[model samples]
Target chain A: METGPIKQKLEQQWQDLSLQLRAIPINPLERKWATIALLIAALFIGIIMIDALVHGINAPSNVETIDSARLHLSEEFAEDNLGVQTDGSGLITVRMVAGRYSFFPKHIDVPAETPVTFRWVSLDVLHGVHIPMTNMSTMIVPGYVAQVTTTFPKPGDYPVLCNEYCGLGHNHMWSNISVIAKEDWAAPVKSAIAGGPENE
Target chain B: MNDAAVRKLALGHLWVAFGAFILACFMGEYQVLERSGLIDALESSSVYFASVSTHGVLMAFVLTTFFIMGFGYYIATTSLKQPLWNQPLAWGGFWVAVAGVVLAAIPLLTGNASVLYTFYPPIQAHVVFYIGATLLIVGSWVWCLIMIVMFSRWKQANPGQPVPLAMFATTANALLWLWTSAGVALEVLFQLIPLALGWIDSIDPGLARTLFAWTLHPIVYFWLIPAYTAFYVFVPKQAGGFLFSDEVARAAFIILVVFGLPIGFHHLYMDPEQAAGWKLLHGFGTFVVSLPTFVTGFTVIASLEIAGRLRGGKGLFGWIGSLPWTNSMVLAVILSLLMLIFGGFGGLVNASYAMNAMVHNTAWVPGHFHLIFAGTTVIMYFAVAYYLWPILLKKPLFSREMALVQLWTWFIGMTILTTPWHILGLLGQPRRISSVVYNNLLTLSWDPYELAMIVGGLVLLGSACLFIYNLAKTQLSPVQDGFVQEIEYAEPLHAVTSLPEYLNDFKLWNKVIAVLMFISFGVPILQFFFIDTFGSSAWGY
Candidate 1:
């Protein structure tokens, strides 16, 4: 046979080979199984979200814009309002600034059974406060405010660490929170600081 | 096509890729040791950060880009039986990429540029680093352009024939890379380069991060596509079976490229730039992308099962034992899929909006990525290297047994390293730390895991060395007489004489990607420009 004809025959054989490789139709039962798997996953996610919202054990909400450079000057994050602030109604809001290597207001004291709003912003780079043993975490991005409100059920110590890498001192970037009983909590000097809504 | 010339060109690229890979493996071992806080003398934050930056760039950018390009060239030529459209341009692209690697190395090695992998801003690197990165990406873009052109030419010449599965997947990746890299490319050109050059006073980090997020997630898929291509096109044949489904493979690639582009906002779930609604949307898209992976797993496993049964094995799972485990290709896939299962589960957790809080930016993040990228993806790269090394060099592998040992060790080492890493994340150990000096009870609990990681890193380093030695020996060994092997593509169970335009071609899918991207990202990105956002000054050296 001539080279041209032989090459053509081989090409035809290759092309014809596909006929044997056709996909077999999947059983309806398999489709049903797939649907069930998807539904279970969706249901799990739904329950998690509902639980988070109902219990207020989630990322902070109502993020407002902020001047990262002027954070120390901002009324909400002023040195005076740095730690725990309680309004007349005894509701607590924790005001803090997360900078390189440290979270301002190193010791955060929040009253248990009180919905304390944790509002923070990054002075330089991005940081994240992950409260261990709780579902409360939020990013501290520069030029924007991060807010989360949750009430701890009992009084205990919860170590807050910066999850996001900021700089050289990232490993040392951590703070402690001493959650005391609501009955032992003291009143705040600056009531309802930042002049926003007093309570959620 | 000049076969000798193409082989030379492909080998050159692969050598460069493997060279960077071996060097980075050494650096990786040192990193684990230093970070374990066990070696006090090795603990320098600057050195650790610099090593990390270089290691990340070499592995993530250098190794993956070179390997993908080289593999693409070989695939396009061998599968299509056509010459690489522009050989000189391909060589030029290779040189440009090498030069970029060299230029980037200067700062990364000297501790001048220590921005770890991600394009998070304010923590700036040297101007040379950004410029070099641009050049590297630009070179890859040239490869992209060439692949698309070759794909179009092939379709034009052969009117109705189904494109070979390998070539189709390669061309799909080229298209995906083109779409995906534009996000980071724009960021570098406009935001980073200017900031580094002192032209811009500051940058809106939110915008920078949003743009990088566009590239971050899809880039993993870009690295992964070649591995997946091997799974679909080569694994069945090597396992002594036909491909289970060609159409399903094509569909998987289509969903991967189309859905992968617009869903990167999942990476920005914790970031402040994008809203929760957009994150949720991307989160859903992330789940949708997982469908292709499921299809791939089922198809690959079924193909292996068919191979095993045809070899006289019986029962559902017994056929797995009948598989040619000595074959590097077969062994790699089984291990790759095992890693993918764990890695993929970790991905789902990361993609979940609420559940992300538990593991985000923790040790779990690195553990998950290393399993997927190194375990699943790079293991396949090794298989491809082993399979192709002999063909390219026109010699049998120097040591098949060594290759098998290397694969096993790699799989074992990765498990040892990442399992503990995952546990550490759950134990509240954060990632990106140089060391933990002030050891208390909680920090002290991490010691055993850290030691395990050190041992794991050492084993992987040894395996990496073995792989390089084997490839080098194969290339340098004297050619055997009558040693001739032609590339063999796996035939599908049913031959496809014809395919729909969307199935055989990417034109339809490209348009689909454009619309989906606009819907997903257009508003989120434009909102940044419309809103009055403050810019943060560069903070890091």
Candidate 2:
């Protein structure tokens, strides 16, 4: 009779365990989490896409148009296009002559908060016009000026180098980009008046 | 050649290649140490870049090419049961190629030819360097011709039969090399030579880049095929298993040859020389090439699975454990494939056009490539050398334990070296830099990783030395094992008999590659000629 109870208990336990197993069914939380993970991934990717779109749309659409103007790079700046004048809030196109780069331009002053269009082409071997401070590096290929544009918010002196291995003295090819503050233009104007005609 | 003659012949070539390799290994260790900025004495930007260039050329071009040629001659004669076609020409190719290496070495050693082993134009090297590189490639071309001729004659004699897998793979590589080298050959012969020689005042760099792109991408496969050959022919047998599929192996080789050539624009994705559309198409082609690799992975794994099962291993993945871990050949594959996974992932990043911009011309590129080429590919070369050395020498290996230790060290060293490289690349370290003279917080952060890389390099150098030492001992060992083992290729799951002409021949794929390459590279390359391009005045010498 005691054996009967043991057998009954074992049968009862087996049934209960079976019911528990049946109740366990497929895990809904794991499935839900998987979907959630996938959605989150999709959403993250979407956010990046939208952000890129907004940035692109807000960017000036001028870059879509290639400047077919024949840009040249000589050893030195063509005497006529030596000086760069920016009219406060517009694009300034600087003509670059590509050849053996010699002169280290200590200060290339650009108006503050202005976009400067670099129309630079190599007159000889490949060189990159690198603005090290801003991390703007563009290839200056032979027969073509790889056109690029960037707006500088802060005005400061930035080192520039020919990033491409152009020749023996590639290490020596260094210049400076002088970003002029908007307020500083008046100082230059005052200096022009104070110091005889502005020397070219 | 008789047994003694064969051993002597192979020994001479092997010694030179390994000797160069060991010397380069020391240089490599120094490079990592210098690059890490830990050793002030090792710090010379000129020396570092020069050493990097020489190390790359010696390991990738010189050692591998010479070894492969010597190995090929042995395999060809033994497997084909025929004498080498045009023996004089073969020797001529060898001598000429060696001369070219010497020519290139002068500039590389002196820091005059530091273009980082790339075909970037107007990066003026000494004229001798360019000429030497050209000669080296031409020498390989000669080998290519000989391999093809011997292959054809063998096939003609034994019609309706499958070529031995090793010979078949070798021939495929020869064909691949012949086709792949043309782009760079043309670029070097015309553009670079003239520039270096002061003959051409200026060249359209876009064209030069486009031409170089043609060679840049596929040459990787040229380096890789021998490793793949070992995988198909040796691994299964070594693991005590059969290859999953013979036909699949053939198909993989054929696909690699066909697809690898047309996908050159992937290298130019960031460059302005090619249009975005072409780069995108090439990106797609790059992904297409991945299919064959996946096929190889599946086929290889399945073969191993079968082997494991045959060894009385049970369960799904449990068969992995059943594999012969002690065997050098089997051990190499596991490590090589592990490297392949990471290297292949990095390759995915490179193929992704947007991400490529993030790491373009960065340290990440070299990190990715070294894993694939040096880690995945060269490790296998070591395994093959171990397996072949004894067979070629007719003696037992001096130390199986040492060989295994070398393999392990190699894998560990590779991980240590390349992990930092990828991190550095992502952290915005540029490739081919002479020095990081400027130090800021960001550059300072790179120090620990560089340190790790140097440690890895030291370990790898030791491993390289150990490998050469073992081979030496094997050759000189007084005890000879009377055991005779033929070259055993793994049999695939499905038996192959009377395979279609496609499997037996490359003629169709050759035609197909010709057409695809034209479509992919034609417009991108031809545009420079058609466009009204302006000429740049001279800059370099």
Candidate 3:
């Protein structure tokens, strides 16, 4: 297993290669290319940073935790308390529960041209809710509450779809949200809140 | 070198990888067809989900782990010109991983563990799935151990010498895996396993996701590095050119491993558990990781440019056409790079902290990964297989024409499959669903894309079959007498007599990774424990 000649040949090849390379003038192309590549990456990061700062298009960061098993028992997410509620300060908050196959308080009514904060909790498995054509999307992890606040300027019926796979019926796990005119929304809210037979 | 033992080991691992791959390809086509709702009898949620889960596991875990392990072993032995450090241990690892895949498959195929590949908790899988996946990681860890040891042994033998670029890249991947797998290993052993076994009455889904995210992103790099290694080590020589720069290739690998970690929070950008600051931080890091890929694209193309010019090419774009396209390795690299450009653009969108909210967990996510992982990464795996089959078996390829067609079809199929997928994401299609039963205008728009995907999937399946058929025929053919061919690694035009220790060794980079990981992940993971968080009881089977 004497490898002296093989090793010598490898060393010779290295020496010859080095000599040949050194004889040729150094190419500044790779160095310039590396710099340009780094700049492109930096440019992307800068744009993202600017977007985050300017548009406030950040992630859902409210790290609020609730017990999944005890969610129904909680004061905020109780069966009777779920759906669109207008607080004293005119803050419209929609509290909903995402369970195995459906979102509780299935049919939701809200007003357009007003800020509505969505507070979402999962009673069982993980589910994600998204309203297409709007900045309303968040994951409803069982133990954590996902909250997103947005204003819908246009009045339309949007499908509240569960994007995350929960179980076999995941595709069917969806509800509907109707965004009505501010003047027209008050009547429906009253009817919707008045012990409407729960969609549970 | 008369290395029959190593050849057998490499061949064994590669066969298993390709085996899982072909099976997954069939499942992939079925999924598209089922999701499209084009056929009535093919609609079963239970079966669809079970198939999706199996397809994901087979492609992501089984195929990648076995392929990287096999490729690593072959690279280590051939590049270093030494036998495997521990042949028996390698065999043991192979069996362990095989057993793990089999054990995991029982639950996955039986519809007991249809949690998708992520296995995010609260939506729990069967306990056997977690245990089996752990064994697979453990088996890969053994391969990692062997690679690192071989690397060190070579370094010791040839003091201050620049290790072979192929071996260096392989060792980098080995180190990267050891660090990368730690996250999922911790999650599985501490959380998923305990919860699955009912030893823990309640588990934090937030914590589970956090830890899984830690493994999720870097694992992509773990898979990609082998492809990048081929791009550097094999492609240039196959294209008939010298490596543009050896030092830069090493630098690219180092940057990938170090920066690839600590950036997993990008995956958690839209989740509630982590804060926007951490996501932004990881987002910046994600962009930083893209630099290596850019550098790789530049270096490899430059190599090809040199190759093309030598073959009498002129004009700015003339080099592209002049390079050898019939050679499988050369053809695969060209196609792989083309996919990488598109996939890398998709990645930029995914990593943009603000833009990510628009596409997170949508049809876009799958579209992005399929382009990158199945498109760019796996195509090179095909190339490497085509290149190695002849050398290891001492038999010429049965059909070079078939290999070229397979490579072209894979690229076209992937493009066709992923393009509409990205479009569907923009149209607000949710991923991982058994079907689109919404029957709305938006959902209706998704139908055309779904139809296109089926066509794409069919093409890909055909291409995959052709790839396997070529390899099988090559291996089954009689070994030619006096057929001797050695593995050829590309030589750098500018080789060095002496190199900085940092470029040649992993000691410093390992420490750097530790510090970076601490900074990026420390608060995100630790916050889970320090906060007043409630755990969720297991829900799904």
Each model's Cα RMSD: 7.4, 13.2, 6.5
All candidates: DockQ: 0.24, 0.08, 0.42
Measured by TM-score, the strongest candidate is 3
lDDT of 2 by residue, B230-341 (tens): 8887898889988867766787798889989999987765455566567756766777677667666666777788889999889988899999999999999999999999
The parts of candidate 2 lying over 4 Å away from their true place are A1-139, A148-200, B2-12, B479-485, B534-541
Every model's TM-score: 0.93, 0.81, 0.95
For candidate 2, the lDDT comes to 0.72
lDDT of 2 at B529: 72
- lDDT (Cα, 0-100) at B161 in candidate 2: 87
Q: Model 2, residue B257: displacement in angstroms?
A: 0.6
How many pairs in model 3 have backbone atoms within 3 A of each other, for residues 3 or more apart or on separate chains, i.e. clashes? 0
RMSD of 3: 6.5
Candidate 1 chain A minimal-lDDT segment of 10 residues: A191-200
Error of 1 at B427 (Å): 0.7
Per-candidate local distance difference test:
0.85, 0.72, 0.89
Predicted structure 2: clash tally: 15
TM-score of model 1 relative to the true fold? 0.93
What is the CA-based DockQ of model 2? 0.08
